[model samples]
Target chain A: MTAGTEMSGPRGTLPREVPSASQDSVPLLEAKGLNVWFGRHRRQALRDVSFRLAPGQRLGLIGQSGSGKSVTALAVMGLLPDTARTTGSIRFEGRELLGAPERALAALRGRDIAMVFQEPMTALDPTMRVGRQAAEAVRLHASATSRATRRRVIEAFAEVELPDPERVADAFPHELSGGQRQRVLLATALLNRPRLILCDEPTTALDVTVQAHVLDLLDRSLAASGAACLFISHDLAVVARVCQDIMVVFDGAIVETGPVARLLANPSHPYTRGLIAAARLDEAAPGSRLPTVEDFLRGTGS
Target chain B: MTAVFTVDHVSQVFQPRRSALAVVALDDVSLTVGKAERWGIVGESGSGKTTLLRLLAGLERPTSGAIAFEGAELTPAGRDSQRGFQDRGLRSRVQLVFQDPRSSLDPRMTVGAIVAEPLRGRRRRAGASSLSRPDRAARTAEVLAAVGLSADAARRYPHELSGGQRQRVAIARALAPNPDILLADEPVSALDVSVRAQILNLLTDLVAQMGLTLVLVSHDLGVVRHLCDRVAVLQHGRIVETGPTEQIYARPRQPYTQELLAAVPRLPAVLPPSDERKPPRPLQK
Candidate 1:
């Protein structure tokens, strides 16, 4: 086994009686011992994962596809399919969410906690106008009057810096550009001023210039609302920019977790090191072999 | 000493079915690619880089302007039509490797059949190496070997191979005809990060060994920096800047080019050894 890697047990240590958790000021979201299995064969997708997000804190979940990063997000949101089995504790504002009744979870979903997905096109209803979509979040979570909801929706659009807020609200999702659509999704997520937000690769589908703008918008909104964020993505530079702390997940486990600056500077785990190496597009000498995850896995005896 | 491919004042306009506005995909774009020179076309989405590449490949005709391959004008005529051109072989000398291999490579076909597709098209023309059945098999095996794939891979279906291996098959198929110019469109974008390096190294090695001209189109400036000798930045269907790779990276002239460079994420550098390193998180009590 490679040095610095512990394979036979839980990959990460949960905070014991977190000084900053519940009593001191509850973490916006906390997950512990999250295990998920799917299908008849009972293939384990995630294994014993644990993490905590303080209020207004930004935590980046970094991993490749099929690494259980998305599954973690799903599990937290109670959006996992019926066939899949899940166990472990997920707390939102010190409230138990795992195995909560669908009625109970649905009530908290858009009002207290919200999500932004990778592809806004599929997430938004093609038939509905963008304004109605934002207003719906407010309607579902709060008892605002119709006029107030309309005003809130327009305000949300302006907050995201969408040009011509009223026109954007009136337009359908397909009518807007990729960046504009993503802004609408942000508007929906922020409509209720939720305490926490779960973003799953929200900028992956966008172009570089547009991605930069979206990242800026997300940063500004998070600051303005002071909401905790679980930002998940495959890009290291993006995570570095938006998150203060980082957790490297692999094969459904948290292989490494630490402050973003600390982990980036000196990654202890081989997987994290491999990820850092792979993301270094500028460092590789011309025509040189790029160090891959396979190289690191080979060291791990996998 | 002559240029391998030249695109002069190329303009492509797509007339929308319902809308009165005609979308200009490329606007008066001109570029010259020299023999054995590796060129990178950097642009965001809808920047007409792909359209310019399609023009060079003869896949689409420019609405205006002209493209010349090896000093001969490329016509809208299909590859089979001579159309007053002396070099009837110009069409076969240029090959394109697409972005998505799963879609590009016919899934129903075996890897061997897919790699030999280009050579089979050339078999009709009489030459010293007319590619007998055995010659085709030998060429397929040789190209596969050059791409770091085993001869056994020839028998397997596209579904049997991993994404990286499928891309290798695509590259092999592109090389089967022994084309002098190779165009790759975001070859590594769909691939996993680990496998991307291997494919890039393979491309670099192949281009050097075969002395083939390379045109790579990607949104990633880092990949461009590593593979291309020269780069052309595209914005709003126009070439805003074109220069050597080192100069472009060190000192970008255009605002768009500067934005692209700024967007490329940098790997966090290994920190200097110091006492500031905190101890690992303790296991829960």
Candidate 2:
């Protein structure tokens, strides 16, 4: 894509023609006033969270750890822990998903909604061959023969640009480098051809160079498969690179929501402003004090 | 300027318990860190950045090549001594801050005890002339305050404090020795986005205030550029490129270094003019 060319805009100016989700289309996934409380004390985890994802659209959920971003994704998947209680509505393809049956959610998980987690090692089974794991993902969602499943797994690995797909498939997770392991996870996520991909800091554990490769692969794959993605990350630059829309969540709620270009051009929330200021370390003078979230919060008296 | 550390053609090799093949972690790597100068060692995982930091911290001796601390060769300690460096002076002069405070800081110990642990080593070496109990308490309080933690924080445990506060405690412990050099291994990599700036700012201030020679190892070039004047790029355990941070960032000599720089996702160079920006308001539920 010509997205790389758009980055050369005199540094401070927003990228030209930033993609925004089509508002007129029927929403693929929609959440309304989502609230989550955990355990016996009913401690609130999420508060009045609401957003919409159009078909084939990319939405970035920006927040730090424990900011309810991950919880929102888990809530959509109906994968929240048993002790947690959720209210409000989550609809996927015009079907209510919040209180869906376990069997029904299981069937929809890998077939329609696939998730890629931050840490590949923990997410993947250490004892299983990486190829077999990919095959298992395919086997669960589809009724393909064993040989066909193996071929599909190999094809998925090749599609994710893993070199020597056969060799990588046979190797254990411990043998592969961090980038290679993350690719295996990505290949597994894409093997089912899910319509929606939920990436929760998929490249957070990777090196910058490896992260670039993975993000590029994801961007290309999403474009090719016409799959929508909900990319969650604490890094605004990374989220901005892959996602068209930005949602800034603070504490348990979203503080701002807008197109990526608009958000970067003029952030309206103090927390969002602080995040942008902190992330622009390239522009910060050497040895100068960086503006923190507290500085922004205090300056605005919020 | 005097060199705080001189790593001469260092090479580190590790052999697994039963494996015939040996892994060369660092191959003929050499660098010099001047006193009070911040140097960043950038590399991917398994590129020997942490291994080099460990070598510099005197946690492990290199398989080959000599390391001189302040012009004095650091030799292995005697069997009777538990420290890595034979010289007591060198042992107390260099301190290390690890990546994750959750695992690095002992969960069993209170914040006060953890920060004061290094001082006890000094006390042991000083014998009768060591600091008194009250003096040690005062020193602990002072370091904690310097790291932006209150004195009351000393009474808490690692789990009781936030991730940022735990890191502050780790920095306070590293500073308790009043060392001339600070070796940080991905110090802020595990922190939240909002908290990273605070820690970086704190490190910058403390390094300047204490005149510390810092060796920061990280994969984040932006962080390295913000903190280090000079940078050494390590690839496959070798020094691929080394120069001023700005020089390397602007015109990298190696293709690998250029690719590494390009891969970093960058925010816009500057935000729009303030007049175009809107004042922020509190989000209503």
Candidate 3:
């Protein structure tokens, strides 16, 4: 239990940061009734999902493996493959996204929307120079020549706090540890000065110590840049730490959404409650049987 | 306390010859799995939780540590005793459920056959006739039912079952011979969260109903907290903290343990000032 209570006591009002009552602030991104369907059968992946993210508001997109959190992130970035069927409105800084031309979406991606996948080892080009890759991202979206792009790449490297940016620029993906590789990816994302950064399990592959550091960097990055973010993760604790508000997605829909503390403390939905109840550590007594496996996780409860 | 398995100052060091990089995976870690204790080994990735489990399962001999089973050293079993202790009778004593259920179960065999594999040795020991074809089928069906799957579901292949169902089949296979100890390594980490509780509950029930010693290895503190009685925190191949789950949670002495507990989502909302924050930042390898 927390030694000191937060701003909202018994009523559990969201800490002053939530901005639950205000909408005047220009949101960097908004998902309004976004719906996604896939396959020849048109299997629905998201149903009427909605959220508003102000500039620099770090939010968590949490759910089990199949919760559609990844799908949602892909859709927001306009990077979904040709096979995926998409519906719904996604506006970026008041710019309409749905039905936008491919060229327009392409221009916005590396510049306005950037993403870091779960596995940096797989996502990165094994043979490509780390600096060269970062430069390529800058060159693609920025109106700059190769020399200027190289300088921007080094600047981006410094922004992510990588040591010896020049040296890292020459190194390949395999030459760095898992956390360093992730930092490279973050640098790549930062190169475009993106407004909305989407991170999909950025630290899942790293050690706890490394995860903590990477997450701290991510947190500071959000604060420093005032960049709105959609952080997708299976680790709810990590999610709770970074995100002011959380959307509990299960299957293809949002099962619950509220301030992180309230949802974890007093979940209204059974699925949300089960996740919290099941998340308990040391609930089992010595020499006694534990509660029935919640099974909420076994099947599609969300 | 009578522990089914005991690790006495065990440590493993992997050295690449001609190089100074001697990777130490375990550091004289010692812990006792008291009989019937649902013990949890919790740590983040590379904290050596899985390596510790591998050591306890006797898959690899520790570089410098003594492991005793029923007061007998396990590292140096005689040839005949090694075969008997490791092969046929292991299911009746200890069994393991892997992290990925789909990959763990062989695709060629049906679920029923998978569950029956462990029963063969157990049947041979209890009575020669006990494992006849029909009897084998009956016992397989019984174990499947105990794990909450119908016998009819056993005829399906691994691909045919969902992730949760596949895990149940894996559990059924592990429990078929009724092992006194079950070591589940991230058994549900790969599954959906909604279904994680059900699998955890099933394991809890099995431990009580069968009087089994469960050594659960997982990075998810939530699952471990819900399932285990005693929790052990491991770091850099060392057992940093060991105590009753409540005591460990209520007051963690080690910095690693405290960091882990702080990372937990269920912790009451306590956003300390930046000065008080000791949360680990990512390390430089």
Candidate 4:
């Protein structure tokens, strides 16, 4: 065992409070040999990346932009633009998704899988009431009466802990603050009762206090529903706070993956170490100089 | 006596409509910025740090209070401060360096023209009817060198230079008028972490060398701890905690202040023979 990494128990679903978590068995969702490219120039957005989304696994996908984190999620959901070309084997409980028809993919989305994006304004309709939008997502996946739909919407809103569902439902996108809008976006994603969620920088646009609240709401919902999530963020501190396991993505490839405690404690890959080192510098030590990019490069080199 | 400016009892309330709720941006916020004070205002979004800086700059009027620059009221008593604000002498006394330098600087204008803008204004303010073309070029070159930029940057657009270089040009423009104080709102927050230190150091050096008073609006407490002697922790339009930076960090009174301090990342200890690491809070499963 690596030094000081003995507390890292086997990759299994242990009790809560362990902080150390990983998957020893098969995952709920698995992607194998994924590839994505855009434009006639064949710009590769993702390059042969693979990871699993196991039940109760709060996995963080950390990387800078163009590092292939977002593109991988988009490809899984069949939401990539027509300009993009893809080749990958995505399996959800032994089912292949790469070649799955558009209709099948649509059925899977919101019902089996849902995504919360960075900007809620883009995910939500500006003109439509937030409640109706959420209701429509629920109705699209499950057959329900108007009253039942209203109940589900209220439940979803309550799940995300929105203060007042009725007022928020009646309110337009502009009426809610940045934090409220993000909660509504999460509520919309949950309306379909998806088993797994793809959170792509959902809290990046929010304030720190509000981001804490949003993250708490997510963890609470995940705990209750047994829904695993792939949480992506550029900040490793936030990732350490939220994720059980982390997959360090860089240059369109996942260079390292391990339990959160193990990865943060001793990152093996150079890129992973660079991220951890960069994140560690944020510690407010007095009188000491913060590490520069050159230091980060040197650490990565080592 | 090296203090360049002081903001005292500043309070601003926006009353857009008769029935609309009045928003108090700052309340009795007072601070004395020393010659080399790299003061930072930190808080969550809507914490009124930006509003306080504006009041200091005479950009907006405090519903009640005063801003004194070397004992001269920024909001002059008899005439509109707006009149003095436009006066090249008063305007150049305190300058603002905005957050997004790319947008703050005119894209069409080259670096030389942007830096030279204030110099020409100063000349015109001094009743210089005209200047020889050679003289204008010489003045621009002098200011550019002082800001540590090469003459070649004179020809490049704001987009041509990196973020740090663009900020340097902005600093050069502000320095052109030779302001005694510079107010920067969340400067370098948009830049990558690596670039942030360079900008912070530049502001520190500028203050020490040029004797500039810097009132920085930022959410970074670590930067504030290193730069400022004292800090006022604002919460919900109120100054919850104000004290020496060392004291505030050592013994945070307000829970919000404590929370903000706690949030600043701690360098993860590369654990020695021991295994377990203690975090501030345990992860809730």
Candidate 5:
């Protein structure tokens, strides 16, 4: 299929370039036949998952809870637990990351590939001031003076559109609201202008209005930095709003993959169809039973 | 229609122990829930939607104004009392289903005991005139079945069940008392997408079958639009908009409501025709 143009939202600005799926341009991050199992019982978490993320491309991995979405992100970050066993290949910037040394992976983590987690409160330190916490990223990635680091932190804070940047910088994690904390996380993620960003349900805990603002900021930031993004979320609408392409995962496997508009208009997989049907509550008739996953899966003879 | 609940200018304020200023959680909120009417309280975090629901559930009395149930004023519970409802009858008539069944369900107790606990409370109050042990067991099984759980499910603990099954247990416990009003707080926010649909369908079916009044609190407008006829949008402890769901969705009067509705992410409006889609296969059962 031909590369689709970037879908625009009310406040969204188009990216610098659309990453063509068929083009032979070198991908920023590529996963091939990735599989993960946990514990002594060998419980499978991910099953032959694979995808390519081109530079400046925003791909959404949409799935329900425990569908191996977060596991995929964690595997890329080299943050999975010790009990788990992983096979297959993960390449970032032409370097194989599957069995790479921890020291090498650590060096690349915050500087080249940053992650923004779902729960900002727990992700941040309660005792550290917000500005100081953000400065840590700059302190580790770059050799800069304390004064310069402080200025950069404030600048990052302002970039994420946090109100009263200096005041927010001084406040602890508890002082800020959920949305504010998430902004702090975003600022930290973008501190080094990473080549790729792995966001796992970053806006799930936020209110709709706050979520929209954060998403808008993320879109603008990614466009400005020209960074590839693997945005993971369970909400289809949220994914469609931010991503150029979407991969629908169910039970640790990709059920369907395509451009957001084409997938939504004509979903081929039963699971994807059920998910779209369930989320499109506006189209559902009031007082009628909503279609569930089982309803769609029953006749498919999977 | 007779009003099941009349919340009259209720305001809840909390004064921090160290702070001189008082935090106003609910600012003179007034609304009426008519009999069998499904009302949704929509809001973002820190918008006081939960505070309003708690006030209606008789869990907390407002610092000012009064709340009436069936035209009778709700008074605070006396000292050493567990519940805030002064009238024991009101306590038995209203039930609450909380978000995150993981925290809501008592993990130590069997599902049967948890569902039957309400019946025992009523029996203790009614002094031997309420349901006997056998009848209570029968009622527990009946409610479990109503929620799509089997009679054998009563023997298992909450940990033994999936997220969806645990929520069903919570629903069974709420319905066992046969309450006239059901208040659910973000019922499906914690569940997976598929499980959320099943629970939503179950709630719709149960509410219709029982003719129960529902007060659903959610941050998702789509869920609210699907389950409720009327909606009350709350922001920072005040009701900004209150009207029919269709009117609120189509033409929001308040700027805040409009912003809230517009912020909700929606799918592209180019779905294929329903008939063009493959027909669902027959149910294996």
Candidate 6:
């Protein structure tokens, strides 16, 4: 139990660096009534999704596949495909992002905001060296000399606890292990000193032990930099472990949103309750049937 | 009390292309599974857990050492080729359910054909009992229902089903042959949180009803504890610890096992007050 509690805590407990400006006024990121439609069918992928993350605050989006968590992230980053029509208000640092010019959004991206994808291999260029990639991110915003960029890249690597930072900097994505590659990807994401990091199941592909370590790394980085995060994942435990606040997404809608401890302890929505019950592997007895979401949906008419 | 399967000093080495160094996937590992026992192998990536499972399924032979089934040595030579478990009788007796059914299940094949293909292989084997088309179809429907899939699922392709249902189809395929031992590698890891529990429960029920010896490999300790009677912690091609599930979780002897257990994410133990009152701030340093 001691070990378990050590991995979990509510928000504002860490030694977080105070935000530069007043965070009480404008949130770091905010989305309102986000509705997304894909292709000619214009089928609803996300509907009326809304949330807010204050500067230095970590917000988790929890949902299963096709729940529009990733789509939400893409919508925020202004990276959604052309065919996908979106109707929503996305504000980053009090600036309207939805329907904003791509050039304007691109200027904020990698400078004020960045994203870490689930699969690091595909996110990274296999042909490019890890350090060069990190350096490139740094160079995108700042007019740094090549030498200064390399030094900053190595510093970012060290920040993420990558061992033998020099050696890791020289290696390619394929040359590194999954954990190492993830760290490199994280380094790239954080290299530009972005105000917010949109992590879409970043640690899902990693092993449990490695996942813990990476989660720790992310916590420390977030605290040190005072950057906000929109952590997205399907695992309830993982989302609860990482973020202070949680939002449960289902069928392209936000079902529940609250402080992590409160929501997990007494989930109001049947879907949230079902998700919590499903993840309770420890409490489940041997040979007993595990309660499924379908059971809740049937009982409560989801 | 009889030993259902025994792995004797198994060691597997793979030589990477253009590299002189050999990757020791499994090194001098030995284990024995008694009848009706549900055993779990837990480890992180590169821990040889999957290699051990493959070896148990007879899908791959060790470069050195031997595996015995029902007290008889399973020779990797005459009856098998590169991918082991070629003996149809042995294949039927020790079936493997993979981590991802999307990749394992053939996309073009209907669910019925995928499940019945194993029995079809068994029929081709000399001295094996052959079943009629209708009997095979009935057996397929039976196993599908056992795994909680409807009879209509047989007519659909793998792509038509959800991830959890695809895994159920995979499980049905594994059970179609009536295997004495069921080896599942991270069966529920690929599934959503809501679907995972259902799948685990299904596996637990089926294993008990069929009286099948079970070998599960997963990185999640909680799932292992929920399903397995005994547990083994593997790291870098070695069994770091092995004991009963309760005892191991209650009092882990190995430091690695302790660390692995600690790494599993648990829900925070705080319950917020009913009102929307803010939590008291911690005292500043």
lDDT of each: 0.83, 0.86, 0.76, 0.74, 0.86, 0.85
DockQ category of candidate 2: acceptable
Question: Candidate order by TM-score, highest to lowest?
Answer: 6, 2, 5, 1, 4, 3
Query: Which ten contiguous residues of candidate 1 chain B have the minimum total lDDT?
Result: B276-285
Per-model TM-score, in order, reads 0.86, 0.90, 0.79, 0.80, 0.89, 0.90
Q: Give one digit per residue, the lDDT tens place, for model 3 in B1-285.
A: 556888999888888798898989889989888888889999877678888888777777788877877666767633444554554455367789999897899999999999999877633444333467788899899999999998799788999888888999999998877678899999987765456666776787787889888899987665676678899988878787888877887788898888886654443443423333222221111
User: A1-302 in candidate 5: lDDT tens per residue?
Assistant: 23433343223221234445644466778899999999999999999998888777788999888899999999999999999999999988667888877777777888899999999999999999989999998888678999999999999999999999999999999999999999999999999999899999999878788999999899888877877889999888788777777899999998898877789888899888888887777777776788887788885422
Q: Which docking category, incorrect, acceptable, medium or high, applies to candidate 1?
A: acceptable
lDDT of 4 at A2: 81
Residue A155 displacement in candidate 4 (angstroms): 2.9
What DockQ does model 2 achieve? 0.36
Q: By DockQ thresholds, what CAPRI class is model 4?
A: incorrect
Q: Write the per-residue lDDT of candidate 6 for residues A1-302, one digit (tens) a residue.
A: 99788656433222223454745667768899989999998899999988888877788999888889999999999999999999979887677788877777777778889999998989989999989988888887788999989998899999999999999999999999999999998888998788899999998888889999998888778777878889999888887766778899999999999888879778898888888877777777766777877778777522
In model 6, which runs have C-alpha deviations exceeding 4 angstroms? A1-23, A300-302, B76-88, B122-128, B272-285
Candidate 2 vs candidate 3: the DockQ winner is 2
lDDT of 6 by residue, B152-200 (tens): 9999999999999999999999999888899999998888878888898
Which CAPRI level is candidate 6? acceptable
Using lDDT as the yardstick, the better of models 1 and 6 is: 6
lDDT of 1 by residue, B172-278 (tens): 99998888889998888776565677688789889998998999998888888888999999998999999999899889999999999987756556642323322
Clashing pairs in 2: none
Error of 2 at B253 (Å): 1.6
Q: Which stretches of candidate 5 lie over 4 Å from their true place?
A: A1-24, A300-302, B76-86, B122-133, B271-285
The residue pairs found clashing in candidate 4 are A283-B265
Pick the DockQ winner. 6
Task: Sum up the clashes in candidate 1.
Answer: 0
Query: Which is superior by lDDT, 1 or 4?
Result: 1
For every model in order, the TM-score on chain A comes to 0.90, 0.90, 0.84, 0.87, 0.90, 0.91
